[model samples]
Target chain A: MQALTNRVKVLDQKPLTFKERLYLPAIFSGMLITFSHLFKKKATINYPEQKRPFSPVFRGLHILNRDEEGRERCTACGLCAVSCPAEAITMESAERQKGEEGLYREEKYAAKYEINMLRCIFCGLCEEACPKDAIYLTETFAPANYSRKSFIYGKPDLLIPDPTKEPEAFAKAQGGIKAHKEKVR
Target chain B: MTNHLNLLPYLSIDFALLFEKLLLIIVVVTGSLVVAMYTTYAERRIAGFLQDRRGPNRAGPFGILQPLADGLKLFMKEDIIPTSSSKWLFIMGPGLAMLTAVMTGAVIPWGSALKIGEKVVSLQIADINIGILFIFGVVSMGVYGIMIGGWASNNKFSLLAAIRGASQIISYELAMGLSLIALLMLTGSLSMKTIVEQQMQGGWGGFLGWNIIYQPLGFLLFLICAFAECNRTPFDLPEAENELNFGYHQEYSSMKLGFYLFAEYINMFISSTVMATLFFGGYDIPFVNEANLANHWGPNIVALLGTVCLLIKSFLFLFVFIWVRWTIPRFRYDQLMDLGWKKMIPLALANMVITGAIVLWLNK
Candidate 1:
């Protein structure tokens, strides 16, 4: 008990010496130090207008991709669901109807798809697990929301409207994204 | 009542009298505040220049409007009161700080007598007979502001700092008071203006004249004591950040904190003015007394010019205060105490004794 109490740093310690107690010389030294820091380069950045470079491996928002002809390649194989470590992804599979040919790559397609972002740890396991050239994690750093319910994403919230999108979705998709997609195919 | 004397038919309101008093107070208060604000800017800029950095040009061209912006910011900030704090006392803390600050400058002879249009005005607020003692009296009370603020804060860090400060200041005040005793003895008057007069009329040349040459030891003791009194570097334990973060005003926020900070600069300025007045001969142009200048243009002009010269000297002394602050390292708490009591007190005593003996021998 005594040893533990002794280990604690007491606020009231000891008396200063006659000279040390006066404290003028020491104060001057401290001022000199703070004054020195005035001239040193400041470590401030003007953010937002200009952004910093992100690493290649930076995990961000998830996206489902379309091929060159604007056709989704997901087969509703359930491979991504099995590989998702966080159990964040959920899906229901339905067989492609007679007229819905080539709309999905496989005979079966994901009829309902959802990802609970709260549970999705951004580990990219689902991205890696899909054999077909479909799911991907993009390089957007921010996926902020006001509430927990807002975090969970559905197909409409996460998906691109047009498969043959003229504008880029992912910032990296302009160059390496297409190349990486071809390699995956 | 009686078949009485007739009342004056044209008795009038003394608006001019009221106006003069109001104008003087306004001028003095405004001047002190302006000086105090710029003193902070000057301290930062000088320190920056010494360390090779541009200081505070961001606020307004060379930070000319920095103090004004600072004042506006402080005024706009929320006035916070700690839940546990004694509300009245906490509010009183900064009030006392500001009061003591401006009060000390009241006796500073800023400029000489001058006629604007027809009315004569002297730069100082009061020419009190107890000028030096008045300074000491007011300065001794400055610690109370810190003490009250710390106590009202209800914080351990502030309390510790307050205790350190009260004891440290009280200890040094003795040496400071003692050092001045010799100066008072040599001049034989408490009036600051009269002391300057004595320094002038002495048969010895003005070169040999000033109190600095006469009581050199007194000047050393007084200077050191002034440093301790003002809580300058080597003596600034009250606000030592390492041991007690933010010192006595740790709990203070916004303009309350600004009050404490601005008051420190004011004290430094006041002390510098006092030192110049006492030792260097307040506003006395060397070898050319106001009487000589009066030969050229009335006594008022000479006195006015003399006042200007004195102000220049005092302003230069203020720069010296900043210079010393940047150069010296703070002494350890123990070292500070030792320097004050063990060193300054004994030297002050010996200086007094030696000065007295010399005076007696010279008279013989």
Candidate 2:
């Protein structure tokens, strides 16, 4: 039984001395250590009142992107659904009708878009696979919900706020994306 | 002289004394309950700080209302009784535990007597002559609560934990009693009021008169045994969750479980008060002669201040208890038994002998 490597060192299995056996000194030292931690900075971020800043590249919940004109950017390409490792994404495409130019960005639009949030691994593969820049992972994590049915996010749940209608919400949702774009530039 | 059956004079009620004692009892009981509630909050907060984390702060500012919230939640929980358990004993366990816990407060002298217009009122609920012995007797009876609860639970783990709790308390009580005997030898009294009075009589501005000066060895032994008696960590084997689940209260639910938990905190509070009374000069304001203060200020103010001083000392002891709990891990069963039987008993015996010799020699 030779040493496997030079790094392998034997543990000291010697009997404890009288002082060590008393344990008072060790206990005192431990107490001092814990007492010192009383002044140390706490590692908690008070939820609701305080939040830790996420890195620019941090991936969280998925969000469907909208163009400057508040029209959907997705052209029903099905690239995100194909590339999704979790197969969380699903959609049904429909031809854009006349007088619906304000709603859809292209001739064909996603009529029914869904993401099974329970199945989502949150790896951002769908965002990576999209060629249209139609999907992005925002800095908002999924909130708790009671039913399994509630986790199946539909188009309305995934879609970002219309910039023209809710400027504040749209800006807040776009904060991480703006920072990410600046970092990339 | 009128008749042999004329016991009316002896049986005459002192209305003021009765009123004062009744008021004091109400105050002490409610005060200890409030202190116990806060102690739970403080324990959690201290544990958090020790581990470099912030404890509960959501219920109210700094989570001050956490104990109330916890109590409400426990009350709201469904009360579950095991079908196989003994109905009466299972119910009686927590009640007995709580009864013994609150009963220990009766003899503790909170402050010097307060002087009203024509009457003097003692702050103690009952200044029993054998105060220390009374505490010991009641504390020993506390074992029955655990024993009955564990046995009645009809679970093997609960029964084993109950036995451990009983034996632990018994073994530790010997050393605890022995250590207190050394203190008793110096004071020559069992009355807690007399012990504090003796401590307040000497030089060095009343601070040197504390019993801790004479019996450091005894104090150390007593403190260790106090922790054991309270079933605190390093001696908390009876409630070893990893091994015994919830111990004697395993089958308990709702307020029954709350009672057991509340009893533990109450035990900590009372032990802290006892340690203060026995060794740290209970209700004796250090560095100031209380008599002079009572003369200068009103007796009521002085009495209130003395009570405050005693509370401050006991709170420090409670902090030390929580601090030690967070610092040390639980002891092995064999190690616990070994410490109690071999180490504490011998050390306490030696302390008692040494203290007795010193006391006799000083008188000579």
List runs of model 1 lying over 4 Å from the truth.
Answer: A1-185, B1-21, B116-120, B200-208, B286-289, B294-304
Which candidate leads the pack in TM-score? 2
Please write out the lDDT profile of model 1 over residues A36-63, one tens digit for every residue. Answer: 7656764443355557776657777787
What lDDT tens digits, residue by residue, belong to model 1 across residues B1-364? 3334344445665878668767877877787688889988888777766666666666777888888888889888887899999999999988998899889877777656667778887766777899888998898899888899999999999998888888888888899888889888888888777787776664433435678878877887788788787788768888899989989999998899999998888888788888888898777777665565677898677777777777677778778778777777677899889888898999889888887887789889
Clashing pairs in 2: none
Clashes of each: 34, 0
